[model samples]
Structure formats: C-alpha cells, structure tokens
Target: MAEKQVQSRYAPDLMAGQVALVTGSGSGMGRATALEMASCGARLALFARRKEPLQETAEMIRAMGGEAFVVPGDTRDEKSVEAAMLKIKAHYGRLDVLVNNAGGQYIAAARDITNKGFEAVIRNNLIGSWQMTRAAADHFMFENGGSIVFVTAISTRTALTGFAHTVAARAGVTGLMKTLAAEWGEYGIRLNCVAPGTIKTEALGRYPIPPEKWHELNRSVLGRMGVAEDVAGTIVFLASRLGSFITGEDVYVDGGETLHMGHDARDMIHPDMFQGRQRGDGKNE
Candidate 1:
C-alpha cells in the first residue's frame, strides 16, 4: 500500500518552536488539542491528574515524530499547578501556549447539588483554570508573552438544566478570561475561551444519557454531534499566529448550538438519573 497521505488545514510549522501545555490531555478534547498542536510543530506538555494518560498522549505525539513532555498534576491545586509549570519550564525552557482543559462536573439539578458539590465544580473549572493561567504567566508568559485558551461549555450562552454547577463555573471562567485579557493585553499576552457544545467524547458516556436521547444533544444548526476535533481546531487557531489579533473572545465551536439553546434540555435532563451523584464524581465533559 502507498504510504498513507496526511492532510492538515494548517501549516506544519505554523507553531514551530512554540511550547504548549494542555491539561487533561489523557483523552477527549484535551488529547485531541495536544495532538493537533503537535502536528503544527508545537512541543507539548501533557498534564492531567493521571500519569498513565499523560504518558499515552505523549506516546501518540512521539509516534508522529513530535515532541511531548508529560507533567502529571491536578489543576485545582495551587501547588500542583505551580509544580507543573516549573517542570514544563525545565523541560522546554519556554512556554508559548496554555490550554486549560482540566475540569469536570456531575449532572445534577440545582436543588440536588450541595454546597460542596457546587464548590468542587467551581474549584475544578473556574479556580483551577485561574490557577493554571496565573502560574503560566508568572513562570513564562509575563515578559515573554503567550496565548491562553480555556475550555468552557457553550451552556454559558444559555442556562443548561442538570448542569447548573458546570454552567456557573464555566461562566465564571468566561468572565475571568475577559477580564484577564484586558489586563494582560499590555503584556502582549492573549487570553480567550473556547466554549464547545456537546462534543462526542468518553465523558458523555458517564452521563447515563440514553442512546435514543443522544440525538437531542445535537440540537444545533449543524444537526449533528460535535467531535473533539471540532473544538481542537478552533483552539489551535486561537493559539497560533492566525488569532494573534484575537483576544478577550469566547469563540463558540458549538455548530450554532447557542442559536437554539435550551430547546432540548427538557427532554434530556432526567433528574432521577442524576440522583445520588455528587460533584467531582463526573468525568471530563
């Protein structure tokens, strides 16, 4: 067989010499983004709470003749974030991009979510992203400058039932990105958020969403569920020179899901299905 041809919309060296750190890179959007960036010639620092998954991501990058460094740590912990940044600096000597993709939230109605549950989601999504962003800036981006992308949910565009906690947390991240972009623009640092709609990933399986109701999750203009690459492509664009002029923006990779938001929530959210579930028990969405 002829050697398989590889096709990419982006220049192979679009991100040459740049070092990017992607959290939650063990699988799903995180892994997809890392691989995409690597293909564009960006050295990767794979991070997540699990070492094995990070290693798996690193292996995939290596298989493609790309460079990858694994730095396993929890994004929600200040110390862990700091240590991960230090490790990335030691390994790559510089950082150019940071993708805050490490976050999770269980499906639960507002009334069923306890204060601890709410706080956990906030810490994981909002506070953890803040921590990673701050550490990256202090360690490398402050004077050198870089791009920061936060993976948020399109639910921020409209209220998402059974995901009140995540919507709130992701909304906070959106606000944080906007404010920081304004504050960091003088430093030549670009900050933005990528709010993805329901992307088909392993995390979706954890939700107990019935196969029949899965169609309801794709209530977007595209009339199809999104895949990780859908969001990963947008993120790579924002982090590359293509989006140098873009900042303080929340690009929706939702296939126009926001255009008809909440239309399917009634059919999808099964309160009973979420019963007994607590925060931190959810998988990455």
Candidate 2:
C-alpha cells in the first residue's frame, strides 16, 4: 500500500531533447516508466484509456519541471493509435522512443478460458502492441529512427500456469519484436523487450493470491520482491542512448525468478507427495 518512490540512477539529462511515447501511462508499470523517462529529461506523450489518470501522470511530470502531453486512447483500436501518433507529431514534431506498456490479462486455467476471453487477451497484449509499433514506424520512427521497448511479462520464460492466454500473447510479442529488430535495423530503429517477473504493483494485488503467498513469491534469488521502479529503470536503459548497440534482446528484469522457476512451487506444496523422500536429496525412497 506504500507509495512507490520515483528515482532514476541514470543521469538527469540522459534523454534530454528527446520525445518519447508511453502507452498505458495511466498507472502501474506504464506510469513508472513515464516518470523514469521524464526524470531522465525526455519530453513525454502519455496514452491510456482514461484521461484522468493520464492527466495525473502529466501533472506529476510537469510538477517536476518536465514536459508531458496526455493523449488518452485504447491501444487496441487502430484509429485511436493513429490519432495519438498524429497528435504527438503535431505537438512534439518527432518521437524518438516508444514504450509499449499497455496490456491486460486475467488468471484462468487454460481449459476454463473461454474463446472470447482468449481472443480479448490476445487483442490487448499482442495485436494492440504490434499495432502501436507499426503506427509509430509509419508516422515518425521510420524516417527519424528510434528505440522501441515492449513491456512483456516473464511468464513466457517460466510458463506460469492458469494464464495460458496471456503467456501466449506475450511470447508472440517477443517473437514479433525480434523480427522487427532485424527489419527496422536498416532504418536505425532498435526494438527490444523488458520482461518483468512478480513485480509488486496494483495489478498483482487484484489476483486471488493470498497475502501469505507473497512471501513465497519473494523467494527470488534477489531475496526481495521487485518494484515497478526496477522494471522502469531497465526500460529507460533500453530506450536511452546508452543502449545504442542493443537490439532484439529480451531482457528479464525479474530478479532471476524466471531462471529459478518451479523451485517455489515445490516449497509451497506439502512434502508428502515426495513419499518421505525430500526433493534435491537424490533419494527415490
């Protein structure tokens, strides 16, 4: 429930004179990324379905003497995306970076997932993100060249259960980004992904997970729960000039959680399943 502090370890002017567009900037990771990029001195164009939250983000940035333009719209709609891009060009004259941070998913077993539910998640996560990328390229990045960072979930690597739809969509985005990286390279445009794992955000709290279960989730090699700032900083790095040579790389900002998948599941479950033989002891008893 505590508020997340906004602070970037990067130089203040790391992105000075640059214009960046961040989708889903109304709250959570998108807002965090926008704040971080603004702190790094980039002029921001914020997008989301709601205008109030987007304006709140803009106010926060402007309060810090940073510039922000709020353009509320749904990422799933091509017309909305095109209009937002046009507004960005008209207002900022150019866009140097884009953070595709808008996406949604609900937990449900693969078998229980309805056809509509699956398609909805796919539309929000994969199709919408691709549309934004294409629009950005068509409007500004194609000629000016820029950095594109897709905020994907680490579920792809860990293959987390009860969310097959989301996992598949994120995986598809990662694959699309890799292909775009190669194709966009000729234009000096770089495309990459930042995969977050178990980040402590408002969205995670909405899940049916028990409070006690959080402790188990924190068993990452880092021995801590990742905050939105952790993922946001990684995004800023990938979008900044410092990552000039990096492209098509999917960076996992998950505190090594993906690398250690299935470890916590075993710990959380009763050991009786082992039939008196504990795991990792090399005993088949």
Candidate 3:
C-alpha cells in the first residue's frame, strides 16, 4: 500500500528520544499518524493484523531515516496485544506513547444490528483499545510516565443514524479516556482522545455513501472534507511535549462539523414554535 501523504509543521526532533507504539499502523489514519510522528523523530512500534502492510509502514519510516519495528497482531485479542507490548518493550527498551488507533465497525441501522454484530464492533473498538492502553500502562507508562491517545470517531458527538455500533463503541472509548486521565494522572501518564469527522481514506470506498452525501458532509463550515494529515497533526501534537498540560479532553478535528448542525437555514421562525402541544400529553392530535 502507498503511504498516505503527511503534511506536518512540527520540528524534525519534536519527538526525539520518544518511543511510540501505534496500533493499526498498517493503513488509514494509523499509518498517517505513524508517519507524522516518525517525521518528528519518534521511534515507532507499528502494530496491525497483517504483516505485509506493517512491513510497508516500516519501510516508509526507514526511508525517511526514521526507526520503526513492525509488530503484527490482532488488536481484539488480549494475548496478541500483550505479546505486541512485550516485543515493543524488548525492542525499544522503553515506551513513551501509546496511540490506540486500531478499530473497525460497519454501518447498520440501530434496529437492524444483531447482537453478534454489535459485540464484534465493541470488541474491536472499545475492548481492544482498552487492552492496549492497559498493557502499555502496566508495561512501561506506570514507571516512565507517558502519553496515551485514543483515535475515536466523531459519531460519538453527532450520533449517526446508520452507524450505531461505531457511535456506541467510540462513546465508550471517550468515557474510558476521561476516567483513565483522572486515575492515571498520579503516574504522570496523560490520557486524551481525538475524534475525527468523515475523512477521505481508502476504506471510505467500502461504505455505501453516495456522492451527494459526501458533499453534504463537506459543508462543515470549512466547506471541505478532512484529509488524514489533518488528524495526524493533532495526534502528533498530543503525543509530543507541546500537549503536556492537556489531558482527559477530546479534540474534534472535523473542520467545525460538530459545533454546528449540517447546514444553516434562513427560514423565519414561527411565534408558536415553543407553544406546540406536548406529543404524548393528549393535546394536539
């Protein structure tokens, strides 16, 4: 797979001496973020399910004269995550940042979603991320102190009609980050989350989105769709020393999409808008 374009403004040594472990580094936002951090001089332990794609990421990092090691493992499995962490600790000798970016969920109406489908998404997005975070904390962050960033989806804020599974999973992840921030602060481990709005990626093609829907998504105040690099920049910032004081907060990098609803209207407001009878109070039929 070709490496995603990474346009960053951080200094070359912004992450010097830092060892970061990024799950799902094979492609998509994970690969983009990994490249950005490597550009900033962070040694990377790239984790993903497939070995070939992880090798591709490692090659890209090495091409830039940066250091990276591929740790191929499924994020949903605790044993896989534990092995990845052990390998990272052995390879890098220390872990400074953990980027929980490995997650997947298919779009389905809330009413149509089956128990098996919902559970799978939860395992991939919520439990997997938590396992990685806990492993990193127990393995290195507890003693060395570090930053942990969870790459969640903006659906947590503006809940999507068809993507209930992802919305719920990401919402849980945000809650986990908030609680971890409070509990892990004493150990000097800062925890935070980054929620990205709809962004252009290879995976976007898999979704059943039409061209007009894409256009509607682009009207997010900025009048454009977000690229992977936009999210990567924020991830690099949180992983670096620049965000030392920021913790337990979520940064929405969606071009102001979450701040305002879809599109603004100029229709006049009715005087009786607030005087409408309650729905179920036996008022207006």
Candidate 4:
C-alpha cells in the first residue's frame, strides 16, 4: 500500500506575495521546506551547489502551481552569494525570507579531526551562513524587513563524541543568530535557528551506523525518527506572519530528544556497544 500524502495544515495563502530563498534546497530538509513555503503561496528561490537538483526542485514546485527560480552556487563563496542575491533582487524585486540551510560535516573524533577538515566545516556552516545573511540584509531585507532561518543541528544542545566539528560550527551559528536577532530587530529583520534531531534523510546514509542502531540511538520522546517535513513545518512558521514577533529563539524540533541530550559518549564512539546486550534482561549475550 502506498503511504498517504499528508497535506499541509497551514492556510494556502499564509505566505502570499512573499519571496523566500532556501539554500541547500536540492534535497532533504531544504527541499521539504521549499515545498511547504510554496504551498503557502510564497514564490521560491532555490539555491544549491548543483544545478540539476535545483532544477528538479523547481520543477516540482511549478507542477504544484507554485513559482520557483533555481540559483546554483556554493554558499562558501562571497562572489557566488553576492551574485545570487543580485539575481534574486533583479528577478523577484524583493526578498521576504532567507533560509540558511546549506551545510555538511563528517563524523570524526576530536583527535582525528585535522585542521583542514575543521576549517572546511566551519567555513561551510558558519561563514557561509553569515555571508548569505549579510548579503540578504544588504540587498533587500534590511530596508524591506524580512525573516531568516538557520538550520542547525541538535548536537548544538549536547556533546556528541564524533561530531566535534559540527557542534562547534553550529554552536557558532546559534550565537550569531542570537546576536543578530537583537541587532537586526530595529531593522525589522527577524533571525532564528531551528535545530533538528536525527532526521531520516538521504544524508543519513553517509554515516556508517546501521538502521536499527540509528533508531536505538535516536529514540526520542516520540519514539521515532523525524522526517524532513517535520523540520520544514517549523521553518515555514518562522518565515511567515505567525512568527512575526518571534526572533532570536533557537527552536528545537527534535521531539524532545535534546531533553536527555540523546546519545552518550560511548554510544557515539563505539557503535556496537549494545550489540550483545539483551534489552529487557540487561545482560550481555
């Protein structure tokens, strides 16, 4: 049997006449967020390093009777970001929302993390997001007043053994958003961060953990892995009028996983730590 296509609960015109830019929108959470925003009547500008995926996302949106423009560029490049913003301004004439969702990282112990790897992750996650935010503010949002959402990780709320680089970079993003929320408030620009727990996306396959282990490690209060749409709804809310007075807040969409901070150092460092343990008996096999 086919799974049912769940429709959005938000009003169809919730974001009418708004222009939203979503980075890393070629797949996973970024693509999900873009679709949701379009369903709410917002014109979308999809950004990603690859043009093919961006084109695909745009096609999907257009098929649903929504408008989308594809902008392919690396977020880490200042010139690329500036050019993208310029194109958006020229095409849309105004920007209403900016979703900084493009970032990536690999799992490695702090000792194993090299300087090159650390710098790459920071540049991609922190510096790239900051550049996009600044360009948007300078180009349109500063005077026009808009919303910005940064997609961070649940690791920012707790320590995970193999994700030293990601935790550091995302933590920086959280701090940046908080400070900007205060500084940009007078300009009518809103800034916030959305931290997702262990979401089941294509990107998850990059990790070496098995499916069952992933479930056990990420067993949140909800007792299930999150889907991309789970994070998308929260983002759409922040970018819409519903979240007008809300800013500088780091919203955790992690189904209470961050409450206990999820995994411990052992679970992350040793993937097979519980392999021989019996669940109810608490005995090693």
Q: The CA-based lDDT of model 1 is what?
A: 0.89
Tens-digit lDDT track of model 1 for 1-285: 122122447999999999999999999999999989988999999999999978878888888889999998998889998998888878889999999999999989899999999999999999999999999999999989999999998888888899899999999999999999999999999999999987888888888788657777577678788989888999999999999999999999988878774445325664543454533434432
lDDT at position 193, candidate 2: 98
Which residue pairs clash within candidate 3?
none
Clash list (residue pairs), candidate 2? none
Provide the TM-score for each candidate, comma-separated. 0.89, 0.90, 0.90, 0.90
> Which scores higher on lDDT, 1 or 3?
1
Model 1 residue runs over 4 Å out of place are 1-7, 261-285
Q: State in Å the error of residue 206, model 4.
A: 0.9
lDDT of 2 by residue, 1-285 (tens): 233345679999999999999999988999999999999999999999999989888888887789999998988999999999989989999999999999998989899999999999999999999999999999988898999999998887777788999999999999999999999999999999999887888887788998668868664688888988899999999999999999999999988887665555546776675566666556565
Q: Against the true structure, candidate 3 has what lDDT?
A: 0.88
The count of backbone overlaps in candidate 1 is 0
Position 170, candidate 3: lDDT: 95
Clashes of 3: 0
lDDT of 3 by residue, 1-285 (tens): 454444459999999999999999888899999999999989999999999988999999988888999999988999998998899878989999999999987878899999999999999999999999999999999998999999998788776888888888999999999999999999999999999987888778788888667877664668888888898899989989999999999999998888666533222444353366434444564
Worst 10 residues of 1 by lDDT: 1-10
